[model samples]
Target: MSQGDERGYGDNDPGGRSDDAYSTLGGTRQTRTRMPRGTDDGEGYGRRPARNSRSLVMIVGVVVLLIAAIAFANQGGGDASGDAGEKKPDAAGAGPTAATGTKPVEGKNGTIASGFAHDQQGAQSAAANYAVALGSAEMFDKAKRDAILSATHDPAVVATLQTDMEKAYSAGFLKAVGLNEDGSTPTGLTFVSRTIPVGTKVTAEGVDSATVEVWCTGVVGMAGDGSTKPVTATWFTITEKLKWSGGDWKIESSSQAQGPTPVTGDNRASTADEIAGAVEGYGGFTYAR
Candidate 1:
């Protein structure tokens, strides 16, 4: 979809990301047998055992030392848990991966978390977490969507975005997504809209403004017996342009693109009921950098 004309919900065209939107604006073994080397051949010439005493003694000593070494190792006094060449990856060196020690936003503008740090790391964190909120199941609800937009976005864009989202999540769009006109799932089914961030990186940064891209994998659809819209997963990246406003980072605008995707997996897909249960049972995380 063209970024220019696609507002959040309008982006949910039948072929677009929200078709699945929860009204959220879219081995082999070889064995070898060795034959005995023909009995050291006739070259031994049936000679009487004229053993080399020195070599015999050396071999005996080496065997004895090997046995002793094995015994000593088995005694468990040394650090034999790992090989000398083995190394563990350092957690800190894993790059800007996963949540660091930094705490998540403590305050909430209603259900949406707020009060992110104002630095680069903080901006990335805010954007990542906000991406989760924007793509959540809650966004299908008007009030909750408004709260999320207000909490995470630049104040300047909130009103316009609200209007855009309402138009985007039209009644037809909701019905197409297995949702009622009010954006709730039909009885006996649960609508799932979840975005799980794989990682976040700041593509650009400034003191008060930064652009962060959150790579995400999400599940969207209705889950239950006889549900036509069984939940399915997709990959996409949300690029949030944020500004330091109200003492924290807030999204000025955001857009999404299809993916920095991976090859498909071979695992069997779950049944509709199984997916619905899983969606209900699993709780989401609040992302941090």
Candidate 2:
């Protein structure tokens, strides 16, 4: 698929950043795990004032955007919460972004969640979980990738996706992204690629089919002891066409778009070591209602 094509963006999208692009989501945010530009004594305002200038510019820009956003929020009543006159994401139990305390599915197809309810919330949950799997570090491996496709995609799409995904994550492609032919990182480096779903919405729903859009933030690339390619995060939305097949929601097709990206914050970027430690220490969430 081409950059803005209907199907999806694969090797054609930039540097083939997404290993599982064939049946998976896309991302474009890139906050690398590296240090800021150095400020040396020999270099003052005369050295390179660009960093300082950019910082100040970003500060002003954010302040203005913040003011405008607050005003807009005030005008828009509490939304999605179904709180009569309110219109905010955090309104109440009806908040689309907030968990509704619904009983989570008790089934699992391998490590991926399965056996979702036959409703809108179920579809949303399936889409969100699938997004995480498709954007995960596990997708780098052929076997794990296949398992994910088998578990999440419609059976009709499984075979073709397996082939397309193989091409998308070819050996050369893996090497280009700082991974071995087998998709393993160098001795001391950690390869990071994980998606965190922020929210889900059912755009189109029916008796047996639903289209869900999952907003996600993902980190990818290599981080660790002497890695030049530090891990970076990207924001993207994945639109999945799902069908209630075989007693559960199965993804029929999926496409990704750049973002609903927010403004970059002033928070300092973490170092490669810190990032590696965090990824190693933290585990992913299994099921969410």
Candidate 3:
């Protein structure tokens, strides 16, 4: 559309061939009159000639039915395979990008997703979820961190994790990150710490154990107009050695390292309030492979 003439109708129409222009159809040059709406075919009030009304209705009906039939055919024509005659992939899933059709675990241990299936796919899902819980801002709070560890970790490792995390989130560390000693944000600033899993891979699996790697991206720091600790995104991968304990996959041990990060894009970053609002408003999902 050209500027100031976007609507090509009425007053804003970009003028094309005028009505008096000679026609080129059938190798003839006959001048024709273009009648205004409601006056075509000598009929008034936006109507066509009564004699041709049946033909017009039939034409329109045929067009509509043809369109409908074509749409119906197209709806069932999606086959992500080599040829129309080839057998399609399984309904559950196929290929790297396909949805597995596997339902996520329905249980939650405290606020974290739990009770994953005893399979490779289930281990991947658990690793992703455990990464989110472990990277959350709640880990800076003593009680909530304990709850999170107990929910996500193996029974033998919860106490050890609790002790390590307590030292990791010391009062001095909280002050350095512009958070209060209790993990709460100061008067007006919002503390943001959230991890989102980008992808998960099951490296090894056994009858009752698995090792899954979750590639994650996260934002952490204070979000306020002029806060010193503006939120920043970090990329990392967490390798979790999981055990199928008590009908669910639990984190026996986990370690994180620098990422398989991608090159940065040129998109403009959002402001503090926008980031904070997004962090608070967005709800996470229960993932399944």
Best by TM-score: 2
For candidate 2, the lDDT comes to 0.58
**Which ten contiguous residues of candidate 1 have the minimum total lDDT?**
23-32
TM-score of each: 0.67, 0.69, 0.66
Model 3 lDDT per residue over 216-236, tens place = 656655667876655555455
Instruction: Write one digit per residue (lDDT tens) for candidate 1, span 1-289.
Output: 1010111222212233322121111101111112244433222111112224442332222222222322222232222112243333222322433335666567766765577788766876786678778767787677787787778777776776666566656676566556789988789998877776676666555567776666666665557887654455556666666778979888765555555556655555666776776777656665555
Task: Let me know the TM-score candidate 3 reaches against the reference structure.
Answer: 0.66
The residue-level lDDT of candidate 1 at 211 comes to: 65
Q: lDDT scores for all predictions? A: 0.54, 0.58, 0.53
Which candidate, 1 or 3, has the higher lDDT? 1
What's the lDDT for candidate 3?
0.53
- The local lDDT score (0 to 100) that residue 225 gets in candidate 2 is 74
Q: Which ten residues in a row have the lowest lDDT in candidate 2?
A: 1-10
Which stretches of candidate 1 lie above 4 Å from their native place? 1-101
Candidate 2 backbone collisions, by pair: 77-86, 77-87, 78-86, 78-87, 78-88, 79-87, 79-88
Backbone clashes under 3 angstroms, per model: 1, 7, 1
Clashes of 2: 7
The C-alpha stretches of model 3 lying farther than 4 A from their native spots are 1-95
lDDT (tens digit, per residue) of candidate 2 on 42-63: 3111111123433333222212
